[model samples]
Target chain A: MAMSVDLPALEQTAAPRAAAAARWSRYARPVLGLVLPVALALGWELVVALGYSNGRLVPPPSKVFETIVALAKSGELSRHILATLWRVGAGFALGVVAGTIMGAISGYWDFAKRLLDPTVQALRAIPSLAWVPLFVLWLGIFETSKVALIAVGVFFPIYLGVMGAILAVDRKIVEVGRVFRLSGPAMIRRILLPAVLPAYVVSLRVGLGLGWMFVVAAELIGASEGLGYLLLDGQQLGKPAQILAAIVIFAILGKLTDWLIEVAAAPLLRWQDAFGARGGQ
Target chain B: MLALKEVGKTYPNGVHALERFSAEISPGEIVAIIGGSGCGKSTLLRAIAGLDRASTGSVTLDNAPITSPHAEIGIIFQEPRLLPWLSVADNIGFGLADLPAEVRRERIAAALARVGLADKAVAWPRELSGGQAQRVAIARALVPQPEVLLLDEPFSALDAFTRRDLQDHLLDLWADTRPTLILVTHDVDEAVVLADRVLVMRPRPGRLFEEITINLARPRDRKSELFDTFKRRVLTALDRSLDRSVRDVTDKSSAGEAMWW
Candidate 1:
C-alpha cells in the first residue's frame, strides 16, 4: 500500500523531468552537429593568429567571411545568386516534366518499356560531362546550353526513380485498385501517384544535387555571373578567400534547397513507416 | 445469384490451375472453398473477383457476365493491402469516391464504428496492428456494400486467436449486409465456423472433390461435438484429395514413428 502510494508521486516527478529532457534534446541536436565545424574553424583561426604559419594558401574562416560580406555589399552576390537560381529552377522543371512523362509511359505500358528502356539506359550510362560540348555546339554558349546540360544531369535519376517506383508498386495494392473498378485516370491519380511520391521526392533531391553540379560545369566552360563564375574568377585572380567563400555559399545553398524539398515532402509522407522516420532517436 | 459454368484457367506456361469448376451461389450464402496447396483455390476466387479471366466458360453474377472487375464485387486478401499513404478513414473511404462528401463522411464514420476503429480515423495504416489493419480492410470492403465479397484466405496470415476473433467479427459484419461471401482457405476450423457450405477441391488441375453442407445455426460453438465432426469430415476429404501412394507413404511413416514412440 505504501509502495503504490509512492508510485504515483514517482510518476508525477518523472514525467516533468522527461519532458524537460525531450525539450533540451530538441534544441541540442542541431547545436551538437555544429560542434565539430565550429571547433575546427576556431582552431585554424588561433593557429593563424599565433604566427605558426602564414595562412596565405588556405586563409582562416574570418577572411572567407570578410570576402563574402564584401561581395554581398557590392550587389554582385545577388546577381550571381539569382542567375544560378534561375538556371537550376528552369532546368529542374524541364527535367521533371520530361522524366515523369517518359517514366509513366514506360512504366504503364510493356510495349513502350520494351521499345524505350534500353535507349534510356544506354543514354544514362554516358557521362553527363561528355554531353557538355555537344550541348554547347548545338545550343550555343548561352543560357540554353547551360540549362540543357543541367536538365540532362537531372533527367536520368528522376526518370529511373519514377520508372522503378512505378514498377515496384505492390501488385496486391494494384489489385485493390482493380477490385474497386477504378477508371484508368482514377487509378493513376489515387493509387499510382501516392505510391511513387516517396521515391519521387528522393529523386527530385538527387536531381537537384546534380543540377547544382552541372551548373558549375556549365559556368566553368563559358559565360559570366553565377557562383560557378565566382569560382572561376577567384581561381584566375588567385583569390583563395573568394574561392572558399563561393564554396561555402554553394554548400549552404545546396543544403537549404534540399531541406526545402524535405520540409515540403514531410506532410505528404507523414504516413510512411520507414526507418528514417525515427531518425537518430 | 452468382453462377460459374465450366470455368477453367490455363496459364501461358502450360499449367492448368483450375479445370472445369462450376457452382451456383445464391445471394447472401457464405461458401468456403478448401483444398491442399497448389489446388487453385485462389485462382478460382480471383476469377470470380474478375481479377483474372477464365480461359474457358463463364462467371455471371445476376445474369451479367464478369470479364473484368465489377463494382458489385469486393475482395479481401490474406494481407490487408492498405495504401500506406492514406489515413484509416481515407482508406475506408477509398471505394466510396463516387459518393458525395457528406455521405462519404457519414458512411466512413459508420464503417469505422462498425469495425471498432472509430478512434483510429486519423491514424496511418502503418500505425495499426495486423488485426486492426485487417479490420480496417474489412470495413473498406463492406463500406461500398458490394453484392459479393470474395475473401482469399483473409485470416490465414493471422495468429489462431486473432484469426478466430476476425472470423467472428467477419460474421457479425456479414449479418449486416448479407452479401454473398465466397471464401478460400486451407483451415478446416475456419471453413466449419464461417461457411454455410464447404467445397473441397482436389489438386493437380484443381477440380471440385466434395461439397459438404454445414447445417449448424449461427453463434456456433467451436468446441461442440458437431463442430469436431464437421472438422473431421473435411480433414478426411482433404486427405483423400491427395495422391493415394503419397498418403500411404506418409501414413506408414507416421505409423513407424508411432511404433518407435
Candidate 2:
C-alpha cells in the first residue's frame, strides 16, 4: 500500500502539544496503581500500633522503613546492592551474547538445533541451587561460584526465548526475503535479528529476575558479603529488624532493575516499528 | 525475450499439472495467463522464473538457457511479501543492497516516489492496506531494474475499487518500465483489462486452450461497447473450453519442434 505520509507526518498532524501530553498521560495510570500499596502501609501502621503479635512475628512497615534508612546510611545497602549488581553484570553479559548468537544459529540451521538444543535444555533442567553444591566444590565458596550460578540461571530462559523469537518470525516476511534473493548473512542481519527483538527484550527482562533469584540461593549456601549474605547473617543473629531490612531491599531492587530494563527497551522497540504500517511489530 | 519449450509437470501424487506446454514472450509485451485451478499457470510462471525446475522442458531468456533465478527476472506472488521488520524504504531498497549505498538509496527513493509512497519510506509493512502493500511489492520489483516481471494473481484479494486503482497504477508502471510483463489470473474481466494478449488455459494436463490478441487501445474503456464485446467473446470461449475437454490446443513454441529441441 502506498501511504503518502509517515509517522513524522502523523506526529506533525497531531496538535504539537498532543505528543507531549500523550507521553505524560501514560504515567498517570502507573502512579495511580501505587494507591493500594499506600493504603496497605497505613493499615500495617495501625495494626502494629495496636500491639499486633507483640511486635515479634510482624514488624510495622514504619519500623522496616526506618531500618531500611539505617542500612542505607551505614553503606550496608549500597554495598550489597552493588555486590549483587556486579555478579549479575558479569554473568548476564556472557549469557546474553552467547544465547543470542546460539539462538540465531538454532533458528536458521537445522544442524545447530540438533547439536545445541538438547544440551541447553538438559542443562537448564538442573536448578540454580542444585548447581550451588557442585559450583562450590569446583570453584570454591567465593565470587566465582556465585557468578557461575547466576549465569547458569540467566542463560536458559534467554536462550529459549531468543530461539522462540527466531522461530516465530512470520513466514510471510521470510517469503519477502526469498523474493529479494537475500543472501544468507544478509537475511539474518536485515530480517531475522530485527524480528527477534521483541522476544529478545522480554528475555532480557527475565534474565534480571533469574539472576536476582540465583544470587539469593547462592548466598544462602555461603558468601562473604551480599544482600543474601546480610539476610543469612540476620537470621542467625535473631535480628528480625535486620532481616526485614534486607528483604525489603531485595524486593525494591528487583522492581527497580526490572523498570530499568523497560526504560532501556522502550526507545529501541519504538525505532524497530518506526517505519511499519503498525506502530510496533 | 523468453520462451518455454515442452514444459511438463506432475505432482508427486501423480496429478498432471502441465504436458508438452510451450509459450514465447517478447520484450515489452504484456501477456495475461488465465486458467482454472490445477491448470499449471502458476507452475509455468514458477518454472520460467527459475523458482522451480520443470519435470521436463527448458526455459530460455535472451536466448540463454535459464537454470537459476536471474537477477533481472522478478516474480510477484499474490501477497505483497514485505518484511515485517523493515520500513517501506528498506524493503524497497532490499534487493539493491549489492549496489553502492548511495545508488541504492536513490533507487529506493525513485521507486517509492513512483508508487506514490515517498513519505512512507520509514513506514512498516503492517500499516499498509492490501493495495498499498502490493504497490510496495511492485516498487520492490522495479527497484532492481529487472528486465522481466511476472505477477501471480496480485489483485485478486483487493476490493473492486482498490483493484481498479491498482490496475491503473500497474498500467502506469508498465508504461514506464516497459519490461516483458506476464500476469497470471483466473478473472476473464481482469485479463481483458490489463493484457496485450490474453491466453486461456485448461486443466487435465494444462496447455493453452486459446490465445486472443486483444486488439484494443490503451486503458481500453471497460464500459465501452468494444470492451463488452471482447469480454463476452473471451468468456464464451473460456466456458466452451471448460465444457468440452476432449480437444487440446497447446502453446507450441513459435519455432518448429526441432528448432527448440
Candidate 3:
C-alpha cells in the first residue's frame, strides 16, 4: 500500500517536470546557435588582453564595439542605418511590383513568353554592376540612381522565381479550378496566388539579399549618408576599427531583416509539407 | 442527362487520342470507362468534364452544350489534388465560395462528417494519409452537390484495403444525392464493384469496343462468385481491347486474380 501510494505521487510530480523541460528545450534550441560566435569573441578578447599583439590593422572585438558606440553617441549610426534601410525598402517595393506584373504576364500568356522571355534572359546574363554607369548617367548620382540600381539588382531574381513558380504549378490543381467554373480573377486569387506563394517568399528573401548588396555598391559611388559611406570613409581614413564596426552592423541588420521575413511568413506557410518544415526529421 | 455524340480528339501532332466515341448516360447512373493504357479513357473523362474540348463532336448536359467546365459537373483526379494551403474544412468549402458564410460552414461540417473526417477539419492536406487526403478530395468535390461527378481512377494510388473502404464510402455518399458518376479506371474489380455499366475502349485511335452491364445489386461482396464472373468478363474484354492472344489472356487473368485478391 505504501509503495503504490509513493509510485502514484512520484508519477504526478514527474509529469509537470517533464512538461517544463520540453518548454525550456524549445527556447534553448535557438540560444544554442549563439554559442559559437560568443565563444569566438571571448577567445579573441582574451588573446588581446593578454598582450598577444598591439591589436592594430585587425582590431579586437572590443575595439570594434567601442567604434560602434562612438558612432551611436554622435547619432551617425542612426542616420546611416536609416538611409540604407530607406533605399532598400523603396527599391524592394518597386522591384517586387514590376517583377510580379512582368512575371505574371510572361507565365500566364504564351504569346508574351515567346516574345519577351528570350530578351529578358539575354538581359539577365549581363553583369548587374555593368548597368551602374548607365543608371548613374540617366538618373544622376543622387538617391534616385541608388534606388534604381538597387531595384535592378532586386528585379531579376524575383522575376525568375515568380515565372518559374507559376509555370511549375501542378496542371491538375488548375483543373480543379476549371472544374469549379471559377472566373478568371477568381482562378488567380484562389488558385494561382496560393500556389505560387512559397516560391514567391523564397524569391523575396533572395531579392532582399541582392537589395543589400546593390545598396553597398550604390552608396560607395559618391554617397555621404549610409553605412557604405562609413565603410569608404573608414578605409580612406585608415580607421580599420570603424570599418569593422560598419561591417558588423551590416551583418546584424541583414540577419535581423531576414529573420523578420521568415517569422512573418511562418504562419502563412504552416501548411507546407516540405522536408525543412518537418525539421529534417 | 449527359450525352456524348461522336466525341473525338486528335492532337496537333497527328496522333488520334479518341475517335468518334459516343454514349448517353442518364442521371443517377454510375458509369465506368475501362481500357488498356493509351485507350483514351482519361481523355473521354476530361472531355465530359469540359476540361478539354472534343475536337469533332459534342458534349451536352441537360441539352446545354458543354464547351467549357460547367457548374453542374465536378471532378476528382487520380491524386487528391487538395490545395496544400487550405485546411480540410476550407478545401471542402472551396467551391461554396459564393454561398453565405453560415450556409457554407454548415455544408462543410456536414461534408466533413460524411467523409468521416469531422476531427480533421483543421488539419492540413499534408498532415493526412493518402486515403484520408483522397476522402477530403471526395468531400470537396461532392460538397457543392454537382449533378455529375467525374472520377479519374480516384482510388488507384491507395492500398487495396483503403481503396475498398473508400469505394464503399463513396457508394454510401452517392446514395445521398445520387449524382451521375462517370469513372475512368484500369481495375476490373473496381469497375465491377461500383459501375452500373462498363464501357471498354480499344486503343491505337481509341474507340468504344464493348459495353458490359453489371446486374449485381448494391452492398457488393468482393468475394462473391458473381462478382468474380463479372470481373472475368471485364478482364476478357480488356484483353480483347488490348489485342492480346487468347493464351496470354488466360495466363494473365489468373495472375491478375492472384494479385488483386
Candidate 4:
C-alpha cells in the first residue's frame, strides 16, 4: 500500500546525488576501519616534529621504518622472523596435535576421562609462565626450553576448546549418526571433527597469540637470536628505534599469522552461516 | 520383516515408559502408532532403530536381535538432523559410505530427484527453509534404501500446508519403495490417512489399547465418510484413555474435599 502511494514521489525525487551517495556507501566501512590507524601515525609524526619526548629516546614512525629497512638489508630481520616463526610453528603443531588427541580420548571415552580429566583440570590452573623456569632448568637454555614453554602455553586453551566442542555437539545429529550405523573412526572423522572445526580454529588463534607472549618471556630470560632477543638487545644498547622496530614486527606478524589462519579455514568452513559474516561475503 | 515381542523400557529413575509393547510389521506395510505425549511412541521407534534398548524384551529385524544400530533400518527424527557442515548431496550420501563411489552418487541423485530437490543438490542445510531441510533429511534417510523406515513425529512441527504436502510426498515415496514403515504420530487424521493399520496406545504404563485396520482404497479421500469413521474411532480410543486419567484426578481431588468435611 505504501509502495503504491509513494511510487511517483520516489521516482521524481530520487536524484543522481542520492544514486552517487548509495554507490559510495559500499566503501564507507573499509575506509572508516582504516581511518584511526592513519590518524594515529600522523599524530606520531607531528609529535616527533614538535620535539615531544627526546627523538633519540623514543623513535618516531619514520625511524622505526628506516630501522626495519636496514635490518632487512642486512638479512637480520628475516633471520629473527624465521627463528621466531620456527619456535611458534613447532610448538603450535606439537600442542595442537597432543591437545586434540588427549581431548578426544577424554571426550569420547568415560574411563579415560575419569582417569585424566581431574589432572588436566588441575594443571590448567597453573600459569604457563611458571613452567618456563622449570623447563629451562631441566632442558637447559637451549631451543628445547623455548619451544617447550610455548608448547605448554599453547596446550591448555586448545585442550579446553576441543573438549567443549566435542561435549557440546548436538545430540540429534549424533542420533542420526547412530541411525546410519557409522562406526567410531568414521563418525569421528566425518561428523565430530567437522562439527568442531570453528571452535578449534578459535583455539588455534588463541594459542598463537599466547605462543608469541611465551616466546618473548623465554627469550628475555635466555636467547641469542629472534625478535625477542632483539627486544632485550635494544633495551641494553639504548636504541629506541630498534626497540620500536621489534614491537612493530611483533604486531605485524601477529596480524599476518591470524590472517593466514582465517584464509586457510575459510573454504573448510564455507557452509557456516551463523556468524553474521555470510551476508557481507 | 520386523517384530517387537513384549518390549518394555524402564528408565534408571524407574519411570516405566513402555510396558509389554508388541507389534509385527510385514515386509511392505505402513503402520502408524497414535498416542498422547509420554506414551513411549518415540521410545518404541528408537528401540526399533537400535538407538534405545528395551529392558524387558527384544526388538528383532529379520530374525536378528537389534542390539546395536544396523544399516538396514532408516529413521527420520522430528527435527531435521542434517550435518550443517555438509552440502545437501553429502548429507544424503552419508549412510552410503560403504557403497561404491559411483553407486553412492547415483543413489544420492535419485533420492534428491525423488524429493523434488534436484536443483538444490549443492545447497547447504542452513540455506534451506524448515520444510526444505526436512525434505533433505527425508532424502538422506531414503538414499540408504533401508528395509525398514521409522518416523517419529516427522511432520508435526511444520505448517499445515507443508505438513499436507510432505505427507503426500511420503505416501508417494512409500508406494514406490515398498519399505516397511512405522510412523509414530499423535495426529489421528494423519494416522487414518496414511497407515494400513493404526495402533492406538494408552499412557500411564504405555501399552497398545487397540489396533484398527483401514480398509479404504488407495488415495483415500479425507472428505469421505469412511475416512471420518476411522479418524473418529482412533480419536475415541485416545479420548477414552485420557478420560480415565482425568476421572482419577477428579476422584482424588474430591476425596481430599471429603477429608476437609
Which one wins on DockQ? 1
lDDT per residue as tens, model 2, B1-261: 888899888878898888877778899899999878878899888888777778898889988887667888888889888877678898888788889988888888889899999878887787788888999999988878788999999899999999889988999998986988999998888888898888888877787887777778897799987787667767865776686655765433221222245
Off by over 4 Å in 4: A1-28, A50-54, B245-261
Which residue pairs in candidate 4 collide?
none
Q: What is the lDDT of residue B104 in candidate 4?
A: 90
| Residue range with the least summed lDDT across 10 consecutive positions in model 3 chain A | A1-10
A173-208 per-residue lDDT for model 2 (tens digits): 765676667788887788778778888889989987
Mind sharing the TM-score for model 4?
0.91
Q: lDDT tens string, model 3, B1-261? A: 999999999988888999988899999999999998898999899999888888999999999999889889999999999999999999999999999999999999999999999998998887788999999999999998999999999999999999999999999999999999999999999999999988888887888888888878898899988889889888878888787442222122222344467
Candidate 1 per-residue C-alpha lDDT over B72-188 given as tens digits, one digit per residue, 9 for 90 to 100: 999999999999999999999999998999999999999999999999998888878789999999999999999999999998889989999999999999999899999999999
Q: What is the C-alpha lDDT of each candidate?
A: 0.90, 0.81, 0.89, 0.85
By descending DockQ, how would the candidates be arranged? 1, 3, 4, 2
A25, model 4: CA deviation in Å?
A: 6.9
Identify the superior model by lDDT, candidate 2 or candidate 3: 3
Backbone N/Cα/C clashes per model: 0, 11, 0, 0
Per-model DockQ against the true two-chain complex: 0.48, 0.36, 0.47, 0.45
What is candidate 2's local distance difference test score?
0.81
Using DockQ as the measure, name the better of candidate 1 and candidate 3.
1
